[model samples]
Each structure stands twice: as structure tokens, then as C-alpha cells.
Target chain A: MTAPVDDPATDERLLSAFLSGDTQAFEVLVLRYRSPLYNLLLRSVRDPQTASDLLQEVFLRVIKRADKFHGSAKFSTWIFTIARNLTIDHARRMQHRRHRSLDVPLGAKEGDAPSANGTLVDRVVGTDVVGERAVDSQEIQRRVAAAVELLPTEQREVFLMRQLQGLAFQDIADVVGVPVNTVKSRMRYALERLQAALADFEDHLEGTR
Target chain B: MSTCEQHQDNLLEFILDELPSAERRALSDHLSECEVCPAVAQRLRRGLALAATLPIEEPPASDTKAIMRAARERSGDASTSVTASTSMLPFAMTGRWGRVRAFLVRPQVVMATVMLLAVAFGAWYVPRRAELGQPPAATMTQPLVVASSGVSAPEEAPAGPDGGEDSAAGGAAQPAPAPPDTAARLERGLQAYGRSDYVAAIDELNAVVSAPDADEVAWTSAMHHLARSYQQNGDCASATRRYEQLFRRSPSYNRSNQAMLEAGTCYRTLGNEARARELLEVAAQDPATREAAQTELQLLGEPPRARRPARQPASRSGAPTAPTPSQRPRHSDAPY
Candidate 1:
């Protein structure tokens, strides 16, 4: 959680505890990172099962080699670097982009802005979770998912890592093995692209009220 | 650093709430005065807020439970069966090839690749000259490598003076290369050590160990290989002394545990059982170097492994203080 960011003892501390033979700290560490790690693999492999399996492999690999982690690096960077290498390995083997059938908007057009009276965005933002609203939420998700899918792989990684994972720019540089400047540039590009894609949705939200 | 154009990008970062407070303050001030930036910032914030409304994709409860259970088991045992709990890494390029690709873009690796080529040539050509009954090119001209600047150790060192050195040789030099720099000399020493030239290695490493010009990094590599050189050259006296100096000066050196281990081995070689046991006990504290120290301890007719907390010493009279069975010096376990 982002709450841990303000805690004096962060991921590195948990890692240190795990390394020093505290098995419980290892549990906390895994729980804390499981979702982000899983989501990263999901986005990369575009398969929940493969992503879940890969997440297991990532933590296992990190644990087996945890004794070798140099404390100088943020544990987040080290773990993400491992995650990235594993994802890259999958990418190399497949030799193609992961398919995202979710990118195609349903019950709506890709470029069409949401309507005030009734639209996918209206149903999602509205306080309803019934039969129709659930479908609406799913559609909104597909649209948002496509927005990320449209991004270049590097830009998407920067976005997922920054916005979702809340990683610092410096740590993202370590994960991607790029200069911090490059990471910042990539994030800027991702934010701009996401902003453009989602602008209509924001306008719809404001217009409805 | 924010120009009007750059501030536009800064506006996006600010809206994401990712900018540092000082930059955030500067941007806030900029937005208040600038005609276009405030509007741009507001739009960006709203757009970002819309994106944030994307629902979180929570992992399956079963998968989370399975993962947490595996983590619990795996953390307890280093050799636990990975198959039951872990999946194989998805990528095939998980080894040296991947690291090589990563290194390709780094300036340090480019310099190192060039140096490795030179070292490879030297390793091939220098010996061929000797075999061909001609003076070695190394003897005629300097084959010095430059000292790389960085803390390269990938694992924790004991709480002591930092004396860590990575096995990879690096540092940029002129096309011809200077032989006098500490890094170059240290590299030359390691090359000699590699070729079984213990005498040459000892001399070169000694120069780095004693020189005022030598930095801590140079001192580490030289001191480590120097002791090995002495031990290999059948001089345990000097090897033990050098190892002792390294132990004292750099308690936190990457090879500090190895220092204790080697010094113990050297003392064992010199028939000094008391000194050997003393150092071996210290080496045994670090899990990294524990097995080797225990092996040597057993070789000296002591218990197989007398594990102890680093702060707690072994029983004063309980330890079997017999001399080593043989006079042979142990080989250093340092990766470099």
C-alpha cells in the first residue's frame, strides 16, 4: 500500500527481515506486492492464468536468490527488475505482442464520447451495481483497458508502474534499466496519451452533473 | 528547469501528484501567473482523475492464498521444492545472454568488452610468445587495465570497513593505457594470478596494497589476491599477515569473511592451531562463508560445525585446539 511509502521501514526493511530468517515478514512482503506483480504480468502476458503463474515464479525466484540482494537498491526495483526479466523472457519466446481482445469497445464506438442521458460512462459513475450497471462497469473497464493497450510497451510499463504501482521515477529506471530521464519521459508520454484518451470520459462526468 | 514548454509536461506530473513538493510549489506558482498552464493543469488533472477511476483488478482469492502459503514455506527453507509452489520463469533469456543485452547499452560494459578482448588477446598471445621462446609482450610493454569506480558487491558485507571488489575488471583508459594507476596494476595482478604466476601476482598485488595512490577498491582486490599469491607461492607467513591486515582495515569488505577463512587456513598451513581456530570461529559466524570454515575446522580435528552467534564466542576450553593434519595451504574461495 502507498501507506507503507511514508513508513520509515519500507520494502527494503521487509526484505531485510525476510533475509534474516523471519518467514512472516516474507508473507507481508508477498501480500503487499502480489497484486501489482500479478497485474504487471497480466498486462504483459495478457492472460490471468499465465500472469498468476508467472507471479508465483517471480516471488519464488526472488526468494531463492533473496540472500544475494544488495541492500543499496530499493527492494522494489530489484523485485521489479526480476519481474521485468521474466516478462521479457516470455515476450522473447512468444515473439509477438500479447493479444488484447478487451481493447475493442462493445455497445459503443471507440472514438465516440459518452452521452449525458445514457452511456457506458454514466452507468459506471452512477451508484448502481445491478444487472445492467454491472455490464456498464465491464464496458468502462474495457475502454480503460484499451487506452493502456494502445500505449507502446515501454510507455505502458511506465504507466502501470507509476500510476498503479506508485513506484518512484528512480526505481522505475532501475526496473527498466534505463536512465531516470528516459523513465520520466516515458511516464510523461503515457500520462499525455491517457489524458487524451480519457478526456471525453472526464467531460461526460462533468456534463452529467 | 521548467520553461513554459517543459512546465506543460510538469503540469501533467503535478496533476498525477507525483512531483516533489518544491517542484509542485514552483508549478503552482507558475500556474497562477501563466495564462495557459493553469487551464492545461486543470484539464490534465481531470483527465488523470478519470483514468484513476479504472477499477482495480484484484487477483483471485485462491491464487493469493496459494502464493502466500508458498511464500511461507519457501522462506523457511532455501532448498524447498519449487515445483509444488512455484512456476517456472516465463522468459527463456534469464541468463547471461539477457545480462549481455542489458550490458550492451551501458558505457561501462562497452569499455569492459573492449578490455576483455584485450585481456583475451593478452592471455593468448603472452603465453604463445613464451612458448615460442620470445620475450612476453607483457614483460616488454604494460598490460594494465583501468580501475572501475563503483561499489560492485551484490551481497551484504559484514559490519566492518568496506573492502568489496567485483570480479569484473573495468574503467576507461587511453588507447595505449597507463600502467601506473592502481586499478591498472590491480588488473595486471589479477591477470598474473590467473596465469599461475604467483610470484608476479604477489609483486604486482603488493605494490597496490602498499601504495598511497591506491584507493580502497584497489586495496581490496590487491589485498585479496595478494594473500592468495603468497599462499600459492608457499609463504603462509606473509599470507597470514596480509590477510590479518585486510581483516583489521576492512571488516565490512566483501571478502571479509573469506579473509577470516583464508587467514585461518594460512595459520593451519603454518602449524599455528590456536590462531587458525580463532580466525575460523569468526569466519564461521557468517552464513556465506560458514561451510568452508567448518570444513577447515574439522580438518584440524575439531567438531564438524560449531555454529555460534557472531557476538557469542565458542567455549574457551571446549574447542579442540589441535594443529592441522597437513601443511598445505587452502585455496581462496573469492570469486575474483
Candidate 2:
């Protein structure tokens, strides 16, 4: 991903300069980090509108608490930590609301609200309607989403942050508040289960050949 | 740990393309040596490749910019209000003055003032008569002879030997001063300045600054050091003024660039933003002047102004120069 292009040193320097009374240095810092931070949050939270809202909240917190970024870790790590914590808090709130509402179970909800999951990908891909093509691409994506959802929560988080979000394993450990080995183990178990679940399709392809 | 478990775990991250380079190499080596690990590694890699290809969609590009702009605007507002809150600080300090004035305006301060006046009057007026043994409303005190009645006493004296005599009559003794050798004094002043005795240097330099026939070198150098002395003494205001004088009078002095930077910093420290920016911008555009200017302007949130190459003053030659203003370098902006 071209390493996301926001130089950690430069970001920290801008932050330090801002704290030292150069307010405008912060503008460049904000402009530079916004996109990567937005992408990270969107992928984690999985809701575009909510992710957009939380992205603003993250930057607002960044500016207000700029002095607290003491360069103890790489600036990227610190920023992602902020994003991670905010994402978790947001998810917890969402979970509480969802539980209180006591809505339908997963597969039924998926069937009824095809537009919710399927349309998001279709709209993003800008193709014909998601329902028009239930072929390999859509089926594969649906299976991948289901497989990821099926993982234990901690394993899912570790997998998302590590593989999809491109955070280092150490950072995943920090984000999830576990030992690095524990994160690795969860990822191992998660990957094994996914591989097993997709074995039928692999075997069916072998048979067709 | 069991070999099967370890191999399986390594296969997971290796398949996902998430293993670090060193670990990936190690896993590759392990797969080549361990027969059973290959099947596991292959299956995991294939499965992960399939998962990766499942095409997780990104948010639309239009949304990216829109969201970021909204984020920036929100944060900007938050920071602006924080800045506004800081601006209220001076007013809070001034609030104490109002409270102090209110207390003073109460009847208590006036009553104390009256009481003080009464005690002072009794001590002075009532004691004077007894101390002098003068009584009753005594006859005519002849008009006190005021010196040189028609002329004004010239408020003290003009600050010289004659002034000292007038001062002596008012109850202090006077000392004679030696004649000053302007040339010798200036020479010694430069020497003292070179040795860093700025106190003696300023004393010597002051004589040269005021001398009627002072050479430009001596006058400029003296002013520069006088400014430096004031700066070293923590009198930044005086130092800044002297530096301004040095630059204005001798703009091509060896230290003029340094002086300009220092003067800009002093103006900034004193909260004169416009003047500080003006000087810093000029300094920042010159190749010779950029470093110091860089530090100052980085803290000011302002960019340096474009600088024209040095031109001979038209006043000196009475002819317009060939290089037009538009030919000058454009302002180079540094990142905030």
C-alpha cells in the first residue's frame, strides 16, 4: 500500500510544533493523516456513515489532545491506538443498542436485508445490482464475510486488524490488550477454521476437474 | 509444542501474506525440510488467496474527500474555540484591577486618606512654630529672595560641572570630570567590545554614537554592540530599537542579517506580529538569511515574502535599474 505515505517523523514534528505554538503546522498534519485514518476506521467499524462521523471525532480528539501524544511510540501506532479505542467504544455502544432492541437472528436478517450487506459491496463496485449476479464473485464475498463473522470475536478482531488493516502483530496485541502470542494463536485458530469451512468448495472444484 | 501445531500456525500467517520477511523465509525453509508441512502450507495459502480475492470494497473516492473535509472543519472549529478561550486570559487578569479599584473607591480608602492628611498636617504645622519658637501671627516675613527672580532656575542644571555646583548648593558635593579624547576613547571602546566588556564598550561606544564626525564603521559597530549589550542585559526593547537603527543606517553591515533575525524575534516576543513577519519574510528569502528566518517563521504560521535581488539604490545613481521587479524569485513556501 505504498506504506500509507504519512511520514511518522514529520507528523510528530508537526504535532510538536503545534504544541509549541505554531498552530498552522497542525493543518498539514491533519490533511496528511486524514485519509489513512479514515480508511482504517471504516474497515474496522464497517459502517460508512458511522465511520465518517467517528473519523471526525478522532481528529477532533487529536487536535484537542495533541500534547498527550508524547512520541512514546511511532506516531502511526499512537494514532491507530486512538482509532482502535474509539472503534471499540463505538462497537460496544452499538452492541448494547442491538441487544436492547432484541432484533432477529443473523441468517434471517441476512436474507431479509440483502441490500444491507450485498448492496454495500455492489454500490461500491458500481456494477449492476447485487441480486442480478449471484455468481462466483458475490458468492465468494458472501462466504468470506460469513466465515470472518463466524470467528470468535477476539480472533476476528485480530485477523481484521492484522491482515486487512495491516497493523503489525505487536500493534494488534496492543489494540486488543493481549499478549502477541495470544493474538497469533487466535489468528491461527481463525485461519484453520476458515480453511476447513471452504474445503467443500475446494473439493467440489477438484471433482469438476 | 507439537511439530504439527507449530507448522499449522506458521502456515496461517504465511498464507495470509502477513508474516514478516524473516519469518516467511523461515517458514519456507521449514516447509522444504518437513514433508507434512507442505500440504498444510499449500492449502492455507490457497484458501487465504481465495479469501483475499473476495473483493472487499473500499468506500467511494468521493466520500473520502467529503468526509475528510468535514473532519477538518469540525476540528478547526474545536481548535478555534480553544484559541478563543485562551484569548480571554488577558481579560481575566484585568478583572483583578476592577476589583481593586472597587475596594479603593469605597469610603474606607477616602477616610484613610483624610486621616493621613490630618496627622501629617498636625506633625508639620503644629510642630514648626514650637521648634522655631516663633509665635502668634508675627509681622511681615520679608519676601523670600528667590534666585535670579526674573529668570527660571532651569530645573536643576544642564548635567555638567556647572550643574554639579547647583546640585552642591542643594546639599551634595561635586567632583571634577576629565576631558574626553574622542579618538582614543573610540579606539579603546572597539578594543573593549572585542574583549566582551560590553559595559565599558557601551560607555566608549556611546561617545562615538554621539560624536559629530563619527565614521560609519565605528558608529554602526557601536550601535550593534549597544543593542547586543541591552540584549545581554535582558533589556530587549532597547536592544531591538538599536538593532533597528543599525539596520536602517547601514543595511549592508556584516551583522545586518543576524541583526534583522534577532530584531524580528524581539518583535515577535513583544507581540508585534506584523513587523515581525515583515522582517522575517525578508530574511527568509535570501539564501544567506534563510536558516534563522526559517526557525522564526515556522513558529509564526506565516510564509516568507519574495525577495528581489540586491539592486543599487536609484537615489545613488539617479537612474532606474534594468532588472524589473517581476524578475525576482517567487516566494517559496515551507510546509506548515
Give interface RMSD, per candidate.
21.0, 27.7
Per-residue CA lDDT of model 1 for A118-182, tens digit only, reads 43223323333334333344555665665654454666676778766788888787776557866
Clashing pairs in 2: none
Model-by-model DockQ, in order? 0.09, 0.04
User: For candidate 1, what is the DockQ-based docking class?
Assistant: incorrect
Model 1: which residue pairs collide? A89-B91, A90-B91, B160-B251, B160-B252, B161-B251, B161-B252, B163-B253
The candidate that achieves the highest DockQ relative to the unseen native structure: 1
- lDDT string for model 1 (B1-336, tens) is 236656765665687677889999988888788876666566556645655655557676766566555566666665663532432333323368657655674779889989999999989987788787757555444333433121232122111112133533333233322225666666667666544456777888888777787767668767877886786555779988898888888777766776787778778756677898898898889886676677667656633222210111111111211111011112221111
Query: For this target, which candidate reaches the highest TM-score against the unseen true structure?
Result: 1
**How well does each candidate superpose onto the true structure, as a TM-score?**
0.46, 0.41
The DockQ value obtained for model 1 is: 0.09
- Give Cα distance to truth, residue A88, candidate 2, Å: 2.5
